[model samples]
Target chain A: MKNQAYRMALLYDFYGEMLTDRQKEFYDLYYNEDLSLTEIAENYHMSRQGVRDAIVRAEAVLTELEDKTGLIRRFQERQKELRQLQELASAAQAANADPVVGDYLRRIQGLCEQLKQE
Target chain B: MKNQAYRMALLYDFYGEMLTDRQKEFYDLYYNEDLSLTEIAENYHMSRQGVRDAIVRAEAVLTELEDKTGLIRRFQERQKELRQLQELASAAQAANADPVVGDYLRRIQGLCEQLKQE
Candidate 1:
């Protein structure tokens, strides 16, 4: 499940980068807005296959972009690392001998919070 | 760049949902592992276009999955909303009459931190 979430997150990031404006509209309608492909076709005044092709092309672009870049992959790795750090911090807090661990956790937490704000 | 990040994230998530084990291996080598299609084909003992088709089909699957689910899109939207909220809280804190805004920011910060751990 975690792997699935990470993959979806990366694909989402890649598609946004590589899709053209029309493709983005269709993608948003189909995925973000949960519109059917048939509905997207009607709204865009295109045939079902046409919409399908656009989506396909957009997907290829997204995949190619990911093949060239590792941004999302890196982000997922960082998130995993952050989780490990948080867990360590929690464990230390439970031990009650190292408030410094909690401080580190809080600092990492602040960085994550800033990332969300970005 | 932000939009690119979001798109890539979604595509990654979608691809993770739909790929088979073989496809996953190839995809990891090609994208996350930064191997070329030709290289992957050589490694997998497949024809060049066969590798191409696999990647293409995988891309289609990823796109279809995204079309059906909006997990990454929702995450991006939430991140954007959080940023806006953070900005609002920061501005309120600057106004000097509402330390409550600072507390709210800290609380939201904490939630974001927890999300990272997850």
Candidate 2:
């Protein structure tokens, strides 16, 4: 199921770009529509295993995309940076001699907070 | 390296919970602050390999956290769902006369777009 989860993660990353039209449809149905594998099979008029294979293959492609392009990886990196920046700003605020630094930190903190909410 | 990337991804996901305070500092420096591994080693007052091990071990812990808790995985899942819902809504719009479905789809699409921008 690691393979499934990895694929799902990859597909999630490049849902806009990677999938062929039919694969995208099946992917949307299975994952986004919350259709059961059986339901997908019935809807697509394919065997359960066939539907499963498509999902699996699509997931592999997605994972490959992530490995090569690092879109999701970079997004995750930014999040870490924002959190650290917030902490640094708080530290500066505590130091109290650097109001300018504090102010900058606060602004960054606010932006990060907004991003987290999103 | 895949291991490094995997570790970074994991650390990003559970940056809140798993890392010790010192480990967090080092991770932020290397990843968030974009410090070189050598710089991190110098700052930490350790051998380069020691610093590298700390980072490697820390990354392993983060990956382990993803495996166990799956917070990042779930977030990715939600994003996929929103995209699929948007596509369905567009399809329904093209078909027409399903105002209730269309409205629901539009609402979901709006929320998803908001989430992605975040």
Candidate 3:
């Protein structure tokens, strides 16, 4: 479930704008806010089925965009590299006896963290 | 002109899918393929003015998507960071007197180059 949520969050971050306003709102409430379809329907005066349909369609749109562009996949791959670089930096920092080189490794570690956010 | 082409390429890579098929073809021919507007129109049975209009509208769509998403901008910033990381690694390697630390810094430098390609 956590992995599914992470993938959904990344996909939504990349392509959720392609979804309609209502789709966006419902998706946010459903996925990010963890709202039930019935709860969301009641809150928005929508049929539960209607809310379900909207959220499913929105997910489809996000998935289609991701399938075509692979932006999210590319981002995840980049993140993996950043994490590896972070690991290497930590290892290098530990091995390095030079204070100045250690400082540089520390900077590289910080940069990896920042780029992961990107 | 070089800067414009770079920005256009980045924008097109990010959001060109939102454009129509004809618009994509025309944009590729004009900006990437270096075809003149008249040449594109002649090849595609479009009026030169019509081709220009299609291309312009397509450019607008690309630009608007960039404005809203800023994916291209984020990528450019990340590229900038990667370049700086590369420079820092090189400098740190030079400043370090230890052979093992230098080897570590070289690996970090290589990692920076790889991430930049990402």
Report the candidate with higher lDDT, 1 versus 2: 2
Per-residue error (Å), model 2, residue B87: 40
Total backbone collisions for each predicted model? 29, 0, 0
For residue B5, model 2's alpha carbon misses the true position, in angstroms, by 30
- How would you encode candidate 2's per-residue C-alpha lDDT over A32-68 as one tens digit per residue? 7778888999987899999889877877766654564
- Best model number under lDDT: 3
Question: Higher lDDT: candidate 1 or 3?
Answer: 3
* Top candidate (TM-score): 3
Q: How well does chain A score by TM in each candidate?
A: 0.74, 0.72, 0.88
Give the worst 10-residue stretch by lDDT in candidate 2 chain B.
B96-105
Docking class of 2: incorrect
Per-residue CA lDDT of model 3 for B1-118, tens digit only, reads 3247877888888777777898899889999889898898899888999988988898888887777667888888999999878877887887788777677777778878887776
Misplaced by over 4 Å in model 1 are A1-118, B1-9, B97-101, B113-118
lDDT of 1 by residue, B22-106 (tens): 8777767766777888898898899978887876677677766567544456566645644554454344334423343334445
Give the fraction of reference interface contacts each candidate recovers: 0.00, 0.00, 0.46
User: Model 3 chain B, TM?
Assistant: 0.86
lDDT of 1: 0.58
lDDT of 3 by residue, A44-104 (tens): 9989999989888887888877776677888888988888888778877877888887788
